[model samples]
Target: MEETTMLSLLPPALALLMIIATRKVLPSLGVGIIVGALILNDWAFIPSVSLIWEAFSSIFVSEGAINDWELFIILFLLILGIMASLISFSGGSRAFGDWALQRVKTRVGSQLITLIFGILVFIDDYFNSLTVGQVSRPLTDRHNVSRAKLAYIVDSAAAPICVLAPLSSWGAYIITIIDDILSDYSGIAYSGLQAFIYMLPMNFYALAAILFVFLVIVWKLDIGSMRKHEERAIVHQQLLDPTRKNVPGDHSQDLDTHHGSVSDLVIPIVALIISTISFMIFTGARAVDNATLLTIFAETDVARSLVYGGLIGLGASVLLTLSKRPSPFQMLRATWNGIKSMLPAIYILILAWIIVTIIDQLRTGEYLAGLIDGSIPTVFLPALLFIMAGLIAFSTGTSWGTFTILLPIAGEIASVLDLSMILPFLAAVLAGSILGDHCSPISDTTILSSTGAGSHHIDHVVTQLPYAILTAIGAFIGFLVLGMTGSTLGGLLVTLLIIVGIAFSLKSVITPLPEN
Candidate 1:
């Protein structure tokens, strides 16, 4: 029953075609799911229809055969919506924006601060994307930063930071995958945790991404589509025209009427941050009978922690609003308004989840992995694995799924080639998956990042593409060198130098926006 034929490619190919044709995500994903269901049920009409219905229904249901992740994503996203609304209506965002403008005066400082903030929240990419986007959008906007650029920073920080942070939810899931795959292999000397650690320095895409953000911010090395967006945003700002509203995610109602203090914004954000970290630690601790900090962190339920944090943050927002003498009904109205603004994003997320389920059912990822399983030259194995993994993740729009499908294959291939090649190959898989996830328009993280930064989804993808490709180029070269030299440290140094050099060379093309 495993997917072995060319027919398995139908669903993803159709999905990609749909996305490119319509520039609309929902209908494309829906059509893809329907086709996948039909294929999965052997083209039987009634069974395929039934499968589609079940998939739709499964998005809200947490129990039973459906993955609990679906429910978690739905609830967490809704809660975040409510929280963002509450913060905005409470005048927290405006206050924070004003406060930030005073302290972070320059464009470079604003961007660097945004990047640093994004890096700090490394626990969960979902949380990182939403929180960083909502909190920093106003601040970044004050400095005339384009929503697309803000989206790029937020998106980059999400998965890339989590992948590198060993104590994050991403790291934990990777650890579990490694354990499952290596359980039967007797010759592998390193533990899953150790192997994961060994692969970290070799995660060139992540290093390139993080460093690239810094380079772009410090050197003003804006290039490609981003430069145009940046120029437009700056021009709009310089005109000081009150009628022009070029900001992307500023969908909220007028904030000029609210006379709330800066604490209104600052306090709720602090509450959300503290609550999320605390709940993560608490959940992780309880999950392990005898737990150290590492064990507790690794075992934490990411979605559940987000739920706890969202509720606490919501509570703080309510209390802060009430303290300002707002009526109870007014508070409710603000909360509802926040939820309403987030409805479009929530709808997109639900559809995305459904399509992912359908893709899983059709075994689209496995089919892609099988294509590169044993056909490549031995010397190019590491680089090839990276490229293959990137393609699978790009096509599927799911990096975690790509990791789950490709890591085991990479591990087995490395074992067959030479025991020493194991970690490098695994590292390649990790790097490639992140790169694909970072760039893919359909990626859940990418979607959420755009939602967070208030940028148009396509705008985010288009603007971020050139930077992501540059990083990928650096990573590919690094993998090639690693495969040839068989040295992790040397490969990493070379990759970092190459990316930095590429970044500097880009400076020659940097053209600042026109002055007022």
Candidate 2:
């Protein structure tokens, strides 16, 4: 019954995914949910069409099963939409472009700054990618650099850096999971949360990803199809007049107006940064309360950040409106448009929440977890964990889902093997999941990063996959060496040195495209 139920859910979900891949959003999602519902409810026959109505009715009329996490994600998307809109309209994005461009004259410079931002924001991948992509796009394009590369830079660094940062959101979650696995295992005396700070220095994948981005940028490594695209952008730029493209510099997405100058942008962004820090401090304080509060805090902080983000955005929009410089009304309209645009992502998240809930409730998670733990040999565990994580993220298009599904399994498997190894395995899984999400076009953060860059999401995905895969392979090898040698920090440093050596070797080959 268990296998049959899990297997039965696959076709409808897959059929729905096919539609999503084809870019049919609404119908695809409706069908996807129907498939899950039918399989779970065990109706005599699949209700392909009627199930849609039933879903709607249940979602609207019956509130019991509505997952709060889904709602939280929806609210997160809406807040992001509003935030992006405000940034654009209020000139925060423009100022960032101007200021960033001033410092990043070369491709190497842009890549470095992007890597730095990724390192700094080491919290939420969504926030990191969106922030870095939007702020850096103008500068990268100005350098005749490809948008796809910029997406690669942001996506590659976002989650990896976050997982490594002890104070950031990703770090916190990574620690919590580690803590759980350790608490249960006899030999593993330390908690996941406590050890992350220590193990962070030893995380090979995170170190390798950062180094890879720098190498790809400085060396301008043209792997796979990206080489061709680079040539095309260069040839195309050389033919056109430099002044012809942005003559009046129409930066506004809505109209033909020129993008504002640096001052126009910098202040609000600073405000946002300041505001975020302030909110973080407040939340951190509130989080330290009793266990019950901690649980609520865990459930709500990610969403609370969104709420704070949205509120900050609203305030920034108001100020921009008052400035009368770009026309505040336009900002308001754009913000609304932004929120509307986020609707699809919101729905997809809700469905993800539902599916995760189903998986948990069915107790199928334990059986699957057992199978996974028992099947893999002890020696191959870390490598297998990373590969499995990447596949799950690639298929589901969400790293969080991969984390939710994989962490426990990896933890249990670690218990089944040597409990002391849980941290390494879990870290590998997290890193691999992040790699897949960053590179996969279907992944929401990747999509949003492209959206932030004003590039076709598919183009970004195509361009990034090579670099992402290369780094992942490097990380995998590094993990294998560490597991075999039982050497912490040794593999990561070696990987970094290897990446740097490759970067220098490739440096002479890539010339900048003729200035646009």
Candidate 3:
């Protein structure tokens, strides 16, 4: 492998800064890709152009064949968009909203329901975000909950919940990585599953993030940008900010939504959830002999499974829409409108993927990971590793990639320093990757969370930042305590107290937007 220096950091850093400044994601990602390409080609114009083209093309074709993973993900997104449109046209979303309105009487209840749905869909983060958004949007909107807050709830529940659930796709992937890392050290007695279970308590960020979502909703602790969004929703009945021109996954204007029942929405979503889980099991089972549930998930093709499940869900949605006896023109319009709504998300996703590829070529993650050394104090290792992993994931816009790169380094470091500290170091990396993923504007999960909630992507990113940062502060403190005391319980208790204190303090001083 080629050695990468600090130069690798320029593209993502510039991209992040530009996104914050301009609030324009596409141009920001484009500039980042160009800068990375130029750096790789040493500022040679023609070579850089060629590199950029190659990077873009690689998304569709890799190794002279179709890139199944990327294409499948795109297909699933389109399918989901179409399904959402069909559901709206069939009146299912409206019906479900009315039904929920009768039972969920308060804004808090609606938000809590959204949070509960997020927690239940732990199979995959992508699935969780979109599915939860689809189910919870109508209820939240009816209760005047802002799309930004819904997106925050969806995003918070995604990576954090998936990381903790052993039966989830995230869990399987992490377990595999942990197993590989463990292979290098001979004296370790526990298996990957055992290590993962042991480290669960040590993953302070994920735990804190999940708790933060619940507490924020129950306590009405809206602060910063989130407060502005909530105030608009409550006072003006505007679920979306007026300035947000492009709200992804919004099909309101495109569909009639006046003629169907609750079954129209519930049936398709149920099919999607069941079929996706079935496909995950099926695909995973085919890859391994003597497959246990754990092995099956570990070997599952997540992208492919999503595509398969999406097809089934789309089919169900089409049938439900047809049952409504809409005009042919209405059906076509709904389909087209759904696809159009997702186009923005698709465009952003492709550009994000391209930049991530370019960053990979520059070895940006490796460059970031290489910064860690033995000079760091043993007691500070967990907190430092958490910070380092967060930076790398933030720069790369990929938590799984961060895990792949940093986990081995963490293992090597622990082996040399203190073997018993392996779980803490590994747990810190898990926690930090999630924290960065939540904060990074370019992260796919973050993008999908916005799409799912039908919020302007930048709006979701901005409103969610303070909440993620607050949780991160708590996690950082927890990791510091864990490192010094080596007690997960002590760290967790301190983290909980700190989070509660900060949340209450913010709620007291940050005057909420008053009802008009």
Please name the candidate that would achieve the greatest TM-score relative to the true structure: 3
Best by lDDT: 3
Tens digits of per-residue lDDT for model 3, 1-516? 256988899999999999989999999999999999999988898999998899888889998999998888888989999999999988999989999999999899998989898999999999998889988998998999999999999999999999999999899999999998998898999999999999998889999999888889887888878888898899889999887676789987755556778898999999999999999999999999999988999999999999999899999999988987888999999998889989999999999999999999999999889889898888999999999999999999999999999999999999999988999999999999999999999899999999999988988998999888999999999999999999999998888888888888877887655433
Q: List per-prediction Cα lDDT, in the order shown.
A: 0.79, 0.61, 0.91
Q: What does candidate 2's lDDT look like per residue over 1-516, in tens digits?
A: 355334543633563355547644435545555555556566535453455455444433456665443354456556656655655665556566667777767667866777787777765666676666656665665666666566677777777787777666666666666677667767665656567766775566667878878767666687665665566555664211232221111134533143555644455455555665556556666766654422332433664564576467557655654565556566667766667656544554445434434434343333333345476567677777777777666655667767788887887777767776777777778777777676654466776565555444445666777777767777777777667776667667666776666566666665644433
Please give the distance, in angstroms, between residue 245's alpha carbon in candidate 3 and its true position after superposition: 1.7
Model 3 CA deviation exceeding 4 Å by range: 512-516
Stretches > 4 Å off in candidate 1: 42-44, 62-68, 180-183, 237-251, 327-329, 373-375, 514-516
By summed lDDT, which 10 consecutive residues of candidate 2 come out lowest?
240-249
Model 3: colliding residue pairs: none
RMSD of each: 3.0, 5.4, 1.3
Tens digits of per-residue lDDT, candidate 1, 1-516, equal 255566766777787678766766668777777888888888898998898878788876645665566677667777777777767776777888888889988887887888999999998898899899988877887888888888998988899999988788898888778877777577777787887888899898888889887887787777876887788788766212233333223445634346667787777778888999999999899999998766777788878888888888888877877777766787677766666666667777777777777777777788778888565666688888889888878877899999989998887887777767877888889999999899776688998898888776666777888889988888889889899888888888888898899988887776655422
Ten consecutive residues with minimal summed lDDT in candidate 1?
A: 238-247
**Residue 391, candidate 2: C-alpha displacement in angstroms:** 2.1
